[model samples]
Target: MPVYKAPVEDTMFVLYDVLKMESYGNLPGFSDAPRDLVEAVVSEGAKFCEEVIQPLNVVGDEIGCKRNEDGSVTTPPGFKDAYKQYCEGGWLSLAFDPAYGGQGLPVTVNAIVGEFLSSANLAWGMYPGLTQGAMAALHVHANDEIKSLYLPKMATGQWTGTMNLTEPHCGTDLGMLRTKAVPNGDGSYRISGQKIFISAGEHDMSDNIIHLVLARIEGAPQGTKGISLFVVPKFIPGADGEAGKRNPVSCGKIEEKMGIHGNATCVMNYDEATGWLVGQENKGLNAMFVMMNEARMSVGIQGLSQSEVAYQNAVAYAKDRIQGRSLSGPKSPEKQADPIIVHPDVRRTLMSIRAINEAGRALVLWTALQADVSHRSEDAAERQKAEDHMGLMTPIVKGVLTDLGFDNAVKAQQMYGGHGYISEWGMSQFVRDARITMIYEGANGIQALDLVGRKLGAHGGRAVMAFFNEVGTFCAQSKDDAALAPFVGSLSKGLKDLQAATMWFMQNALAKPDNAGAGSTPYMHLFGLVAMGFMWGRMAKAAQDKLAEGADERMTAKLATARFFFEQLMPESSVYLARVTAGADSMMALPAEAF
Candidate 1:
């Protein structure tokens, strides 16, 4: 069984002490939500996750979901009621708007809550996880009429939401999707196509399912510009805002994925499905990106959440399992054998995983904060800067978190030696579940290219400069904090390496377009690792300050984890930089005929 003790104390400290979330209340609509309210919400949410959903992790893994020939999907037993608890508790709408029945909590609060839910059961958690994306799309692109119709049920969890983007032949290449939509006599369109890998596409937990789909109109152009987004429901809504007549949409089949078995992955075959356009025709691709961004960040959090859970379970196992004597001394000779944590190599593995997990958590929270500022800030310059920061941070959130998250799971599994390979220990499940995070919501390789090829050059290089300036400012401010000297020094050098990589790309992008594609992925990781290291440095400083103030013992424990991160985690930059600087020669040299 995967044991998970909610890290609520650390979560509260990070939100209140490190980020000072109370200041967010002054940012317009949040005047009513105080620190007490936020803390209460977090506490209750944590408790619910630890109790209700955490037990389902292995149950869902072992039992998985069943897909019958009738095209209906079944989640693990008890998932429906557990999902009902989530709905009744109002988790789906925690951070959404109030007019739509949401509680309108801070996004940062949602981040912490989501980490708990996802860590408890990534597969079962994905049902609501995906609904949030569809809800986000409706939130962003749905008109007043559509929003009034759909947002409430989704908010109340009466209806679940899903984004149907992938097709039979297309994965990340949205431009090649063959889905088609024809205008009906009324305002609606008739959609016909096949969509694959649609998670929570067809589930039994909700009364209705709303699908945010992408399909091309007749005579539309041949690429992404030709694609448009539509709201296609499994059943048409009644005037009273409930499920009525059956819509034309149906689940053709469910995918046999290697993991996330409790979440249905559907092969949806739409035959003249009644649909409503979200934005303008042919401009749907751009509009859908709003949901994609929200989904991307959520998926990244999935990785981080899984890693954190993996660490929790791994730590429990390491303490209880005694295999050999301590190399330094017989510290635990009182027992039958020694704790694995006493082994230097095992400590290094655990510490390295800890360092990355902590940094990843901070980075996600910080990014959420930036997003909050971008949307809620009163000052124009502040809003613009926050938007720029978000643009730079998206790839990092999606790319870095997933990459390191998967690595953390593998490392945690490695700590168990042979048992890690066995499913009974539950460590292998973490590794298996973590794999999908990298592949879905846009593959990590594509994310890397986006960072180097697009985000760095966005706004004519100003975004990149803004990012560097923030790092530079942090370094300058921390000059007096000698404890951060090692981390800051490593961070500063990594910053320069990123800058060099950017300059190299800018200089060669046009003359050598292949260079960008060849070096993009490695360069993305190099930059993401540095960004996580930077965030960890900030977290370490905050923890150390608490120690200086004579705080709780948890503060000292956190400080030690931070110290381990700086010493063990910051050394991988050299290897990534080496691979990136090797450039397009090797990748390009393997010609079309070579295969």
Candidate 2:
């Protein structure tokens, strides 16, 4: 079995030292989340996940989930007991409103807890992970009665939740959906349709499953404009607010997927299930986006989680597995062969992944703090600025992290050679599980397009411009500091490349939109490199300050990783910039019939 020790100390370093988290003390949740409290929460969370959740990862993969004759699904053994303990621990309500029986903590704190759980067991984590999105949607759009009836239970994990959107005919194009909802006499709608690939769609873990579904109301506007959102529960709530008779909804089947088999990706059937409308009529997409956006960010964390675990295992293997004599010399003369960690090529691979994992963790935590500011900050201007940064970083977080995460998984697996191919070593499971993150929660290709097509220009490019200014200011401020010169210089060059790519898109994409389409993925990656470089710059500055204050060996290690990122990883932005400038000519030149 694979071993997982949660990166709690690293998380604290990013939260407290690098980001200066205490600065947000005035915020609602931050005031309560003092350093000691935050550390205690993460430490406890790490213990729970490492002890309770991780043991089920390989078991979940092997046994998976099963569908019974009654259309109900059964998860792997110990899942239900684990979930019960999880809910009893109040793990589900850490970041929610205290009025809803939550701890009233910041999303950043919840995000940290989520990282530990995901790293330990991603498939098992999806059950509660999807519920958070569902709760966010209902909290934002659902009416008071819906909130009163569902939000509290959902928050406490007594009733789990799901987002039901995709059908067999549609995934990305919501305008093509065929699901239908007809108004019943007493202010309720009858939702009747099938939703496919619904993660955590059907399970016996909770008392009730509250499904936030999307369907078109009768005679509404055509296409996406006609769509409406609905809250359809597996068991309808009675007047006393408990689950009553079973509703008409049922799971038709579960998807036999390449990974995350533990999560029952169900094909659901709704036969005129009693449902309540959420948000406004003909504005379903707007409401559904709340869940999608949250899911997208959560999915990005999944990528980071897998990368962390893979890197841990790879580092362990590289140290213990003796391969050949070190190129420098036989340092371990008593042994027949030196460990692979001594090899230059092996070090390169390990350092590359280490750089991405650390920087990626910083990026995710930084973005999570931005999310907290967007939601909890008192100043309207501050909230708007944080929201802008959040929008700009979301796609990059989802795309770059998952893409590089999968790559790292493969690289880590390579470190194990043939053992990685077998099941007992458990490396292959990490590769398999990591692959789905790139495909789901809005595929990475779609994420790239969103970065170039939507987010770059949202709010008249205020967000992207804000991002540029932040990077520019950091680079400028650090230019004179000799200890920080390496990171600052690399970041300066990366910012220029990002700006040039943005200008190229502005200059060439309007007249020939294919130019934008063809370059979108590369531009997304370029933007991601700049983002990661900015994070590394911040980390390096913190490391420098800590070293000046006589911190410890960890500070030195942090400096080394930050240097590796600047020297080895950040330069790739220029290559992507080159590709972005190349435009659509070569890609578009081929005739449709040529191949």
Candidate 3:
């Protein structure tokens, strides 16, 4: 069986030392999340994930979700009980508003806990993850009555939520969607549509499911401009705000997916479901973007979560599996053969995964902190900058992390040799689960295009420029420190590569749009490299400071991993830069039907 231990200590280090989260105590939620309280919450969360949720991972995958004749779905065994425990423990309410029965902690805390939940059991994690995304959207876009009716129950996990956007014909192209909503005589509307690939769409765990569906109002303009969002619950609430009547929305079928079998990825059919419009009549895309962005971030963490669990299992196997003797001579003379970990190639692979996982954790936390700042900060300039950071980093995080995450899972699986391909070892599940992250939440390709085609130039390039300046400033400040020289120097070079790629896009993309399209993936990856490189530099500085105060093996290991990242992984930035500047001539040279 695969084992997953949440990196709680590393998470704390990133929170308290690297990100300096407590320093923002003046922020609304930060003051409530003192070091001790945060530690306790995360530690308890970690314990629950390890002891309760992780053991069911293989079970969930084996049984998957089942759809009944009544059009209701049941999650894998133990999931319902585990989910109940999760809600009762107040995990879902950690970062929500106190007014809505939440703990009112920093969003960062919730994100950290989310990583643990994902690593433990991704299929189970999706149950609450989608709900969190829904709450975020409703909190931001839904009217007061809607929020009052839904947010509190959703906050406490008494209700779960799902986003309904992709139809049978539309995935990324919302303009092509044909779902229609007709105005009801009173305040609500009648929604009729079919949405596919809806995670946690229908399940027995929650009292009711709140689905945020995107549909066009009757007589509305054509295409995406006419689209609007609606809140369609599985059971409509009565005046007392309790589930009273069953809505017309029902699960058509659960998708037999590549992985995450425990999650009910349903084909939902709505037969004139009673719904209320969220936000404006024709501004559905804008309103849904809130949930989509939230989901995208969570999906990015799913990538990291799978990679982390896979790495942990691979490392355990490496230490125990005996193979040929070490090249450096007999390290274990008494044994018939040395452990596979003695091999240089194996060490290299492990180091590579470790390096990225550490830096990736830092990157996630840092970005999450930006989310908190954007939401909570009182200053307009600070809020704008934070929002810019989120807009700029979202695509990179979603694209690059998932791309690398799948790659790392494959690498870790390779450590098991032939056994890796087998189901019993559990590595296959990680590989399979990690695969969806790259494809879902606006596939990695779309994420890249969003970065290049929209986000890079958004607000007259303010976000990208700010990112460059912040990285450059970090490099400049750390240049003189010999301890951080390597990381800072590598980060500086990576930043230059990213900057050059941006310039290339600006210069060439307008003349040939295909150039931007072709280069966007590499540019997103290049940006991720620099962002992670920046993380390594900051982490290295923190490690050095800790070492200066006292001796610590953990700090030593951190420095080594940061060095590995700088020496080995950071060099990939140049390759992506090369790809970014290669232009689209050759890529687009092939004509239609040439293949």
Q: Write the per-residue lDDT of candidate 3 for residues 288-366, one digit (tens) a residue.
A: 9999999999999999998899999999999999999999899899999999999999999999999888888999999
- Across residues 131-170, which tens digit of lDDT does each residue of candidate 2 receive? 9999999888988888989999999899999999899999
Kindly give the stretch of ten consecutive residues in candidate 3 with the minimal lDDT sum: 482-491
Model 1 C-alpha lDDT per residue in residues 1-595, reported as the tens digit of each score: 7777766777777776777777777775457668788789889998999999989888888887777787788889889999999998988888888889988877777888888888888898888878877888788877888999999999999999989999979999999999999999799999999999998889899999999999999999999989999999888999888899998788877777788877888889899999999978898877788878887888889899888989988888888889889977887879988988888888888887777777787788888888888888899998998898888888778877888889999999988889999988899888889899998888988888888778887889888798788888998888677787877887777777777777777787668888888888878887777788777667778888888898888877777887676666666677776776677888888769988
TM per prediction:
0.97, 0.99, 0.99
Residue 387 Cα positional deviation in candidate 1, in Å, after optimal superposition:
1.4
lDDT of each: 0.84, 0.92, 0.93
> Against the true structure, candidate 3 has what lDDT?
0.93
TM-score of 2: 0.99
Inter-residue clash pairs, candidate 3:
none
